[model samples]
Target: MTGISYRRPSSYSRLIGVGGARGDRIVPNGDLAEALERDDEWIRRRTGIITRRHASREVLVQHLAEQAARAALDASGVPAGEMDVIIVSTVTWMKMTPGLAPLLGARVGASPSAAAYDVNAGCAGFCYAIAQADAMIRSGLARHALVVGAEKLVDFTDPTERTISFILGDGAGAVVLGPSDTPGVGPTVWGSDGRKGDAIRTTHDWLEYKYADDFRDVPWPTAEQDGPTIFRWATSVAPHFAAQAIEAAGLTPADIDVFIPHQANLRIVETMAHTLGLREDAVIARDVIDTGNTSGASVPLAMERLLREGTVHGGQTALLFGFGAGLCYASQVVELPDAVGGDGEYHADAPTAMSESEEIGAGE
Candidate 1:
């Protein structure tokens, strides 16, 4: 029998462009203060969040994802038609069928044949997706891929719930990956602690909520978490994983120019940074202060903010890590993208010229 042939793999993969999109509504602590019966100062002291974005009911998850994806594609100068894969990592898509990836691909004008799918690894989703995209490119499954982390946590957050409601926000961030001559995305260090999965999760599953005899009394499935438990786990585990990622990349704390961890909480970010003992000049993302905790979208959002603010530049070495929910986490070292697209403004009323078929296909 003749030997089977395989597609030629690329030497490596690297992020080519980056983009971010946030909801239009700016929700301040005062807006949620009455519901939580907590003052803005108290909330600020605890979470370091002054404001967060919450998309209006009319603004669907796909809109944010599309906006981010467009910006990334424009920045990369890689037309959507060239994309071979598109991955969306989100937990609050609110639907079980017709995944967000395909819809986003259609809306963004990616070739219909592109492999599209969704990933739900909780807050670590973006890093997980990036790792997958990198592997796909290196394995010759794809040459150019778009990886997006978008979420509408507001839809699943209960204002009356104090554990994580105020910390939740809605937004999306994305990156374009393509083949590179050398390693631009380093080895990923990832793992999950299923034993502590309950540290952060929804209050109940769909089945429980659907079967409840007292419909009104039964709370809707909403995000909830053991704050203290997650704090301890993240601070302790993040440092180790971050070091492993750096070491895997054949670098050290001194070599990392930026540190973008999951924007879950300011305290967690600070604790992990302190524990890691990175160089004093290393820039740590504090996007959580303004963006709140956007779950899966946090890592890329933080990285985008750093780039937009001119704090970190292209070719700079950075360590990106994310952890939450499923008690899962992923970290990797990467060379920052050279350019970013999109004005970082989300126009809810912006019109699109998508063909009728594309609109219908995207389920818009």
Candidate 2:
């Protein structure tokens, strides 16, 4: 109560200058949608979601991931072949080996040595990935890093786990980080807690039996949720961590221009906004109602929504909150530039040299 020490974030960090996003169509009719039909007033009063996006199984995680990555690559005017490293920040991946990072690099024809791999930090993963890549640039480890937050939750979602099904969606958002002379463009504040990992976690396993010629097996996928505990924990935990981050930068919550909490639940977002003394529209929130919780992909997905809809203009301070799974959470204020390379000029439809689906894998 007196003083909470949020481990200080690395100082050798720079702002991620360019941001990009792309997602699929989202429709309602899961759990909460029906609950809302039960009583519109009740649903609105309890949670703030009117609708959420649901990705089709046909749209693989790799497709959306590549689309989002290409958008950032196009918007930044930095060729995919020029990236220093491409970090895929996700808990859900296209495959177990090569981490999908290499697969992305290979498909795009980035330098053969273009470092690529996957890293997970629950829903807060994107922030963690950005912080890591920023440090690389600020530390002279690399000239540029592509951080992508992508997830095809459809791959792991257990429809039976209706508690989260109504609140989750699939999509990807990407940003390119490089050096900048701007003041607030780089410095960051971040932290994590592994103790409450189970507060919001997903688990999977494989099963088999020995039967020689007459062998048989039944492998199953199981996703669980302790709904109430997660909701209450998020409301309390997220704000505390967010405050800790803003405080670390010698700034108060008032200094932030936008608050982007992982679109977990409408109530959770509203509670955090109220606690932080922020206006409803001050923070960029959407896509979740249509996307559901794309796990760690949520924040960037929301950022992509703002970047495209024109809600988030250049040079705005954004306070992003990512909490879930791992019972883990972290926060950072990104001093995002209004345009690529601080160019005040804005482009509605940035162009990519080659479309992912069109260019990759010759035959669809």
Candidate 3:
């Protein structure tokens, strides 16, 4: 048999646009004070979060993802029909079947033939999805791709759980990537430590609830984490990998114009920046102060905030890093895009919404 042929790869992939969407409800530390039995100051001292957004019970993961994706598409001035691929990174979609990507693509009016799927790398998901999209584009498998990170952590959080309840939030962020004449997206440096997998995970597995001796008495699965463990791992690993990512791009920390780490905590962000020896002029993202830890959506959301506020401008070089859950982490360097959208506004008229009781299957 003749050998299979392949399409020529593109020279590079670059971000064309960025967007974000936050939940409708703003939840302050004071709101969670009674449950966590801690004062607002204590919460702020620990996580650097004064407030966070929580989607109304009526809102679903797909709604946040679709809204963010549409904003990115609109900002890029690229109709959804031109998209060749769509990747959604989320852990709170609830349903296992009928992956959210296809639905999001359809909602955004992407071409029927576009390849779409979901990614579950926890907090590092968005970066992972970006790496994947960059690869696909470089290999000529896609001409334009949409990468989104969305989460509704409220659905998986227990208000009384002091370790995580005060830290979680809901939101989504997205970016559009297309071919570039020069290197715009840099090499990705990523890895995971599964030995610490239990450091951040749901309290119960689906099988445990399904096979429970008393179904009604079974606790619904909610997220929990070993705060100290995650904090320690993230702080130590971030600096190393961030440097590797920068080096992989043939640059040094001084060359970076901005720093956007996972908005996990303010202390972690500061610690990593210092240890990495970044220039004093590098603008560091502190979106966590108001957005809390948005899991996979953190990086893009923070990036969007910086761009929208004029703190960082287009063509600036940024170092992006994300670490959490799976103990997984990913880092890369990229040239910032000019188009930015989504101003933390919640549109009630958004098309996608689902009730809390809905039980949809994966890939349905």
Candidate 4:
């Protein structure tokens, strides 16, 4: 090993800004009901999702990521040239090599020598990226970093698979980190159970299809999930991790101003909230009702929404938890940024206003 070593100072990194972007197409439950023969009420009762955004054939994951990154760069007032590190959390990238970070860095005009890469930890990806970014900053390897969680889950979805079809959506969210005198992000609590990896998954290995006689004829592997298994894991086990994150942050649950768990389901969020025993005035993100489950993008998307919508203000402490696929889980507490976008509103045309029929019929 090279003998070069460095020690971190007492200072910590802070999330200085935030931003989020969703696809143009809005898909409501009515559209899914027509195809699956399930009523809108049934879906709402089951998953608390009334609508979600699905990108058109023209929209790629890169497009959504870049939009959010630009907004974040503007919000932070930190030029892309000043960033020394970039990390993207994703699992829905179509292109496996070259990674999403380099492309995002190029789009945002990051420094030529910046360390950029992508990480895959399913829906827990955002939290994992945050944890790694915090460590890098604390270790003095990076001074400022941009962490993004983005997904194009629709590409892996089959509308006929009613369970996952109505739940998955497309979107991206981002945050900028910078050095601070005090801790802006707390210690992270993370763990995984690989044995339960089959609970939620997609099979897209090239090796499995490399020898196929006709690759075009192959049916793309769609996403699948054991809903009950995941629900039990999230509701029963995630609360413990959430508490650990709070403790690691040198705070108590009662001190938290907001609780932003992964936008997976309303029931899970409620259960976690109750288990944590947070103050009654605490804000909890319920973006899943409209944004659906954006997987890796859920946490940051919810965070940006909370900030942009004025539900939670800057400097308040918030607890963020992300868990799913690979049975992976991660949680941390952070101080909210003062602003979400360079402008007051990040997405001026957010949620894409659409007529009832057009919005619901987007799936067609």
* C-alpha lDDT values of all predictions: 0.89, 0.65, 0.90, 0.86
Candidate number with the higher TM-score (2 or 4):
4
Please, what are the lDDT tens digits per residue for candidate 3 over residues 1-364?
9998988889899999999998889999999999888999999899889999888876677888888888888888889999999999999887778888988888889889999999999999999999999999999999899999999999899999988878988999999999998998999999999999999999987888778898878788898899999888877866898899999999999999999999998988999999999999999999999888999999999998999889999899999998888889999999999999767555878665344334243234
Better of 2 and 4 by lDDT: 4
List candidate 1 segments past 4 Å from native. 213-217, 353-364
- Report the lDDT tens digits of candidate 4 across residue range 1-364: 6896676643788899898888678899999887788899999998988899887765668767877887888899999988889999999777768888987897788888999999999999999999988888887888889999989888898887865778988999999998888999999999999999998987565665787898886778889888898888888888999999999999998999999999888888999999999999999999898888999999988989888888889999999999998989999999998878733222434432223422222345
lDDT for each residue of candidate 2 in 123-215, tens digit (9 for 90 to 100):
888888877787776666777778888876666665545456545666777777766655444344556666766656555444232433433
Candidates 1 and 4: which is better by lDDT?
1
TM-score, each model? 0.95, 0.80, 0.95, 0.91
* Model 2, residue 119: C-alpha shift (Å): 0.7
Cα misplacement distance, residue 232 of candidate 4 (Å) = 0.7
Overlapping backbone residue pairs in candidate 2 total: 19
- Residue ranges of candidate 2 with Cα displaced over 4 Å: 1-23, 30-46, 184-189, 207-219, 279-281, 340-364
TM-score between model 1 and native: 0.95
Off by over 4 Å in 4: 1-10, 203-205, 342-364
Q: What root-mean-square deviation over C-alphas does model 1 reach?
A: 2.4
When 1 and 2 are scored with TM-score, the better candidate is 1
How does model 2 score by TM-score?
0.80
